[model samples]
Target: MSAFDDNPFAESAGVNPFNDPAVTQVTNSTVESVDQYNPFPATNLASQTTPASSSPYQPAVLQPSSEPTPQATATAAQANLLRQQEELERKAAELDRREQELQGRSSTGKENNWPPLPKSFPIKPCFYQDFSEEIPTEYQRVCKMMYYLWMFNCVTLFLNMLACLAYFTTSSTYGVDFGLSILWLILFAPCSFLCWYRPVYKAFKTDSSFSFFFFFFVFFCQVVIFIIQAVGIPRWGNSGWIAAFSVIKLSKAVCAIMFIVAILFTICAVMSIILLKMVHGMYRRTGASFHKAQQEFSQGIFTNKTFQSAAAGAASSAAQGAFQANN
Candidate 1:
């Protein structure tokens, strides 16, 4: 009655995909002949009435398709990705190593270019250096010298006052002679104060020809004053309590000692001038013009003296005569 009742494997695909074989046919009479000689007997239906046919409704199992090929494709792609990543990492590592090598070579090249200083580097004249842009140290030195010079001058001045007092006391000089003495005091006191102060102040403010000019001018006056104070100026009442004062002046020895001190300070002042000239000459050789030369004359000395002397000499004949003529 049913189509499957005749053939059991009608809907199933054939064993081969390309070609199907003919189904084998078995007649009912042949089935009965095979059944008549069966060795096992069927169960009684009355005893199994509570259950349906024991055969499961599950479909027949199909042959498993080959799957190893797809799995191999996926595994191959995964392996290739990992290998590419490792190759990239290796290239990065190589690049890093090359960079380190280049850095090492660069440092080594620098050492080779500028060799290390020997343990015993000989001392050469410092005048032959390359000082392009700097403040001159001579300015500082001169300023300090000026300070000490002023202090020493002031000390002598104070001693001069004490000597004057002694002379007045010994000679009974009519109550300290404040008339002409006051005039001298008023004139010299203010003038000397400005001589040192004005120049030093200008030394800090301006770096021009006028500044140097004023400095030299005022300092020359101070030197002249020192000379006058040293040898002894007659009728100037500069004798103090020393030789020019009363014969029996108090503490004449002490006044003489003060005079010696004035001489020492004058020597120091002379030394300061000599050194100032040398520093100025050295500074001018660096191709600096008047303004710059004046500025750096005390501060920077970045050149060889021979060239400096030539350049400075060429600028001013008097300067050259003073500095190079000594050579």
Candidate 2:
């Protein structure tokens, strides 16, 4: 019974399988290998596998962009030049159209429209005046104002004649005033139109220095004449301030009419001064000078066929007379 209870396979007291050298060595080796080994290593397998002649692994880096090529820069410049050429061509076409329009107008021999009289009237229009066609857009306003001023002056002159006629009725001593007023209306109206007004118009239209100078000279005289007319000196023919007040006691109706004429004269003087200043300012802006005026005047004289013919006839007549006298 004792032998059966005691087994041969059973371990002795204090002797453990786990404490054995072989088992302990195997377990320690496994733990040491686990501690030393690393699943994620810093070493590069590609670098190690590659041959010595191959380059080492490196990170990709972004490079700075290179400058534009000369051909590409030239292409951009050519595009700009082409755009400028197109603009120049467009401007040239516009200028050609304007020239053609001007030529067409001249070639058509357009009828005069100024004075705007009816076809039934005996006196035909003497001039063709179109502000829209002739005058530049920038100068049209001032030019139109000048035309209105001329018309106003004409009306004032006509009123002055009427006033003088009434003054003559008041007294026979003022008969000369009435006569002179008629002469003034006949003379100054046309003279003023031809002299200062026409010169100024030509100045603005053609930008002519000669025309500008002529206008300045003639308009200054006109302004002086206006002042003299406003003064209304006795026997001067103008029914101005002095003439109006002189007839106040004789006939109040005549005095009132003369006073109105005097007022119109004063207004004319004021307007002339204002327009003169405005024209002077515009002249300064236009770069007009006495030298340019002289050159333009000489050119105009030389270019005129009438002047050339007169000069030639005079020269020939003078030579023939001298030859005859010598003979």
lDDT tens readout by residue for model 1, 100-163: 5433434333221112345366642211111122235545555555555655566655555554
lDDT of 1 at 181: 37
lDDT of 1 at 41: 55
Most TM-score-accurate candidate: 2
Which pairs clash (backbone N, Cα, C closer than 3 Å) in model 1? 131-302, 135-299, 136-298, 136-299, 136-300, 137-298, 137-299, 138-298, 139-298
Q: Report the alpha-carbon TM-score of model 2 versus the true structure.
A: 0.65
Candidate 2 error regions (>4 Å): 1-106, 314-327
Error of 1 at 68 (Å): 90
Model 2 is weakest, by summed lDDT over 10 consecutive residues, at 98-107
Model 2 lDDT at residue 250: 96
In order of appearance, the predictions have TM-scores of 0.37, 0.65
- lDDT for each residue of candidate 2 in 196-314, tens digit (9 for 90 to 100): 88788878888999999998999899999899989898788998999999999999889999999999999999998998898898889999999999999897787555887999999
Clashing pairs in 2: none
